[model samples]
Target: MFIDASTNSLTVSHRPTNAPSGLIESLKQYPTANVGDAMDRLNLMDTGIASQWANGRCVGPALTVLTREGDNLAIHRALDDAEPGDVLVINALGGTTRAVFGDLLAEICLAKGIAGVIIDGLTRDRAAIKELGLPVWARGVSPAGPAKYGPGAVSVPVACGGTVVNPGDLITADDDGVAVIPVERAQSVLSRLADIDKFEEDLRVRIRNSAVHAAAPAMASTN
Candidate 1:
């Protein structure tokens, strides 16, 4: 469970056998819902730091990144150490002053099999990112540059888009919003989400039939 401080790498001993199935399926149900609802159910913050460039939904495992102000050495390091099917979670101190990612970063991530990037910071090269068809969730866009300073970490716990993302956790993002499911509780939450989805579907059916009541019945009716 220990990660190398210098290398910022750790062999994940406990891989979720489910392959992030539950929420992934839930996304199918509410194709237009934001990923933030699921995150709120899991007690996550809505960092308001994301935007979609790709057309479809986004779902994958997390690769957390923490960096000092205007510095992305750790982010660069994380990418080098990134594995396939990873979602890069960047904790950029909520700084919208400079872009932490751009066309080059998006290109690198796509080539490495990274699912997406969710950053609590700014990003540039908007046209290029959109052109590349990469999924990026960030606070905003800026043309400012980042510093190559010290004090940063990767593959560790980080807060992005108002969620606490631990390395190897599951992240599912879409036009709805971004949601983070803990690797430990993913299955259970997914089950609950399924039930919610079913109930909502039934409700929709009733509404379509004009069978839904406008208000509660009178107290006398309870008798």
Candidate 2:
């Protein structure tokens, strides 16, 4: 089963099963920042290049995009193709000169129950985006406008920030960064990330009162 871009309808690959409970809870435990650490341990395969552009964190399934340079036709089509618990992933070819997402698009996403958007390009309408409280991660923000000509693809695998993201993969983004958990490996990865988070928490508690000393005598501060 697949989502048809023209009609904006959902078709399940399997039976409409609920997302894993542990995965959802793990998303709550580790903020986007801590997840980045986990991805680093996993060799960086489970991550996205998303810069935080809003207040809260975003964790949901992905709706991948492959768009032409300077045009967002594919992205618009992806939005129509996305499901309620979907995060739009746009492959913008690292173009940051023009804004690929803006107020109107965000409004449409919010109304349609989209989890958030992650673009490898620029975004505009900063004030409205913030006001609407939609999660957006992009290369940067720009006042420049975008073109409409589109020879784009939707629901296809696309490279974002040197990482390949496939449609329906789990995406988590927040103030720290973005991480992609492949649908097949999400459960195991979530468990590993949980253990890493716990260890970090313990380390933080131990380091609270510990004093650092320079190993090199020459580098030590002397009063």
Off by over 4 Å in 1: 1-40, 52-56, 211-223
Could you tell me how far off, in angstroms, the CA of residue 15 lies in candidate 1 after the best superposition? 10
Clash counts for the predictions, in order: 13, 0
Worst 10 residues of 2 by lDDT: 7-16
lDDT per residue (tens digit) for residues 1-223 in model 1: 1212353332222223335444555545543243334444554547475565656456777888888756666677777767777888888999878887888778888888887888888888988888888888888888887765536776677777666788777777776567777877766666666676788789898887663343335544777
Q: Score candidate 2 by lDDT.
A: 0.71
Q: By lDDT, who's the top model here?
A: 2
lDDT of 2 by residue, 183-202 (tens): 78777777777888789889
lDDT of 1 at 103: 86
TM-score of each: 0.77, 0.78
